[model samples]
Target: MSWKDEIEQLRKRQALAKGMGGPEKLKRQREAGRLNVRERLDLLLDSGSFREVGSITGRAEYDDAGNLIDFTPANCLFGRGKIEGRTIAVVADDFTVRGGAADAAIIEKQIQAEKMAGELRLPLIRLIEGTGGGGSVKSILDMGATYIPFNPGWDQVVANLERVPVVSLLLGPVAGLGAARAVSSHYSVMVKGSSQMFIAGPPVVAGIGEQVTKEELGGADLQLAAGAVDDAYASEADAMAAAKWFLSYLPNSIHDLPERRETTESPGRRDPALGDIVPRDKRYAYDMHQILRSVTDEGSLFEMGRNFGQSVITAFARLDGWPVAVLASNPKVYGGGWTAEAAQKITRFVDLAETFRLPVVHLVDVPGFVIGTRAERAGTLRHGARALSAIYQASVPWCTIVIRKAFGVAGAAMMDHTRFRYRYAWPSGDWGSLPLEGGVEAAFKAALAGADDPDAMKDDLNRQMKSFSSPFKTAERFWAEEIINPAETREKLTEFANLAAPLREPRTKAPRYRP
Candidate 1:
């Protein structure tokens, strides 16, 4: 063939692949108020920065003259692109074609995309929807045979988790392997009304004699509350923006480190309100969110697992524009005691921070792990120990500011216990093996039972114990770190962040995750 003829053939093939599924299917995507796969890329990436990887791949129908008659592209689309001046990889599912099912070269392309991201040490943004290259009924009919359920690229998928920063956006109904991919990323988002995720869709559930609608099975509200996904946005555009913002806080890969940026607030900035942030009366509950906002840079707290672990708040925040993981105990829930679910949440959050080499800050108020029949049934101790193990295994710098009560084993798990002299307690802090109120009842039970004025005796002992257990007494022994003014938290934490910045080893080791 002449050069001119070959060029004409190339143009024809490019036109076929670029056409996507066709106008009719694409119109349906628009009618549903969602952007198509190609359109999503345009919105997500810097304009004209996306470089195609497998644009010529698809199922091509050839005529007798060896001329192409039809073409159906792979449901998976991928390539390198720039987001906010940072280079990264993007993989999106083309639901218009085969519902992103097992067809053509989608399975291979999807697997390759994961491998490429890891190899290039780039961040990966997954625009997930449909089946995520899962089994399709039509595929079996076309092949005249059935195959056992399996995920071909799962190994690469799993490897990518530790190698790169991954963000998944659920733009449509995700099922089976699709759901797994959507949830596997470090950060994930879903469109509030349009996105749903499930291990199996309604039709698959019907085969097992169960009846349920798609929304009822795995709606964003249920999934977010259950801690299956990190967040949900009102639109795909918003979700994309969130994904971009998340990447801004993280490095392109585990091999690199997150750079600090300038913020509107100075490092030494302090709010006078934090002086009275905690009430002297231990019985009253204060809003932990207020403390989080006051200490961290303005609008930099990205909270995770807020619903599943109400007792503990795990969030990503910035101190002097340096990213740090913040864990604060909320007294309103179980008296800030750690539950099994809350412990698991801590393990996961710690892993993210450590993997990205971020420092950690603990706003301590824990009384202990949740205690009761319910807690025992939930294996609270087992999960609590795992959460502790995760903290101990982390190599990043850690600091703790004791805001209130910190009692028993759960208190010990608050920070890197090995980082001696690193703990900081507040003036209102009260920590011991057990709170004075509870200790008096247990220790003076015999004395109280025999005393004529049992109630008075109990009250007197509690008062004495509370006075003896003051933070000053512990500081006198040089056991706990200095007890500072509550309002000084931001200034101290910002200084600590500055001190820890140079201590982190290059490409710091990833976190030890609790199962």
Candidate 2:
């Protein structure tokens, strides 16, 4: 009465599952410069840490006498895994199996993965490839029926956004549901040359008179430029490494605050370069990235959305080893003006910080919302309003450093003035409703027009305005809490991190707006 026979059969089924659509399909997958699902999981997680769910839940056939004959394992591979010894939930599409189409997928595995990630409060990593469980004509023929479409476990997916960190990697051609899943993540990446994302593949698009290749339609660079995904990498391994690095900065879920790490860098260490990074001339754009890296712990800044939303830089960095959200204006792009894309990026980034209980440090150098017919058509002001709302709604500890120009509505958004203003200004801070350069003529139109030499009068008015616009004037009025030397930025920011660490409380946040 031993269960040895059944145990052997179970092992046999598990072995079949491991085969993963057999060697031929796997060979093709490798030839396409992609790793199989199992290989991806191995690379993504700590060695030998994957504990697979539904190992044998797939199409099976048996003899009339009830003896097993053949089995085809499900396309969806999901389980609990470890990244840097920390547990995470992973759901990867086995593209070798029917190209990971709906017919070959075991939907229960995906649903359970999402559910477990939320219920157990673990970060969810989706290695998306193929169509992301989207149906095909073959499925209808196999089932002998057509049905109205609906996502099976979408509630869990949406809930996980607030409950846990969701990272998706687009590793291959992804269409329909796959594309949606990648964009839904808190962070997403694509392998540069291999990955493509679209509403539908080229074959389907050709029917609509748009004959385009997959790469032409939705290449990594294209999607990154469109703000569809956070970043891209030259290789799948690099992308996976990036995902691990991103998770290292945050906790398993919103129910836990980000843990601090040990760093050799001194909190009071001052980089002299910070003092000269911002040129006195407003027309010149200094390297914001250099400033960001100098202010944070060595090699700790993990930037996202680099290609799209060029005017704003969003990243996760550590100050004295404390995880913090870093937002800065990229003066190199439109003089740090807020474009529609930049505003949208800010809104999403602020929501992420609020959801995860990450303290925010803003490096302000904004001019204003971009103006012109192109900006107007893009609804720049509307998106900027949403970004402002996100910033105001965030309850996290916030610190703002006015490095240079901070004018107009965009500048005012550097921090919520109504809150306890934990803010500072540099010697070069030039803030107001409008800058004096182009604004003098518009503001003092009659005064300049009545002058004997309008241009000279305008220059004289600018000089007077510049004197009033000095950061000293703002500091004297207590409009800005303090004006500190640029070299002291690291000390002040490290102090802010220490202050914010105690205030970070672990709890679920309101639903994040994903735009």
All models, RMSD in angstroms: 1.8, 1.1
- How far does residue 78 in candidate 2 sit from its true spot (Å)? 0.8
Worst 10 residues of 1 by lDDT: 506-515
By TM-score, how accurate is candidate 1?
A: 0.96
* Candidate 1 lDDT, 1-515, residue by residue in tens: 46998888888888888878889989988888889999999999999999988987889899999988898988888999999788999998888887777654457888888988999999999998888754677778888997777888888778777778888999999998888888888888989889899998999899999899989999999998888898888999889988887888888888888889898798788788888878888778899999999999999988866777789998888999998889889898998999998998888888888888888999999999999999999999999998898888887889899998889999988787666547788888888888776788898889889999998998888778867887899999987769888778899999999999887665644443221
Candidate 2 local lDDT, 43-144, one digit each (tens): 888999999888898999999999999999999999899988899999999999999788898788889999999999999999999886557888888889
Per-residue error (Å), model 1, residue 408: 1.5
Deviation in angstroms for 12 in model 1? 2.5
Q: Once superposed on the true structure, which residue ranges of model 1 sit more than 4 Å away at CA?
A: 508-515
What lDDT would candidate 2 get against the real structure?
0.92
lDDT of 2 at 21: 90
- Against the true structure, what is each candidate's TM-score? 0.96, 0.98
For residue 314, give model 2's deviation from the true position in Å: 0.3
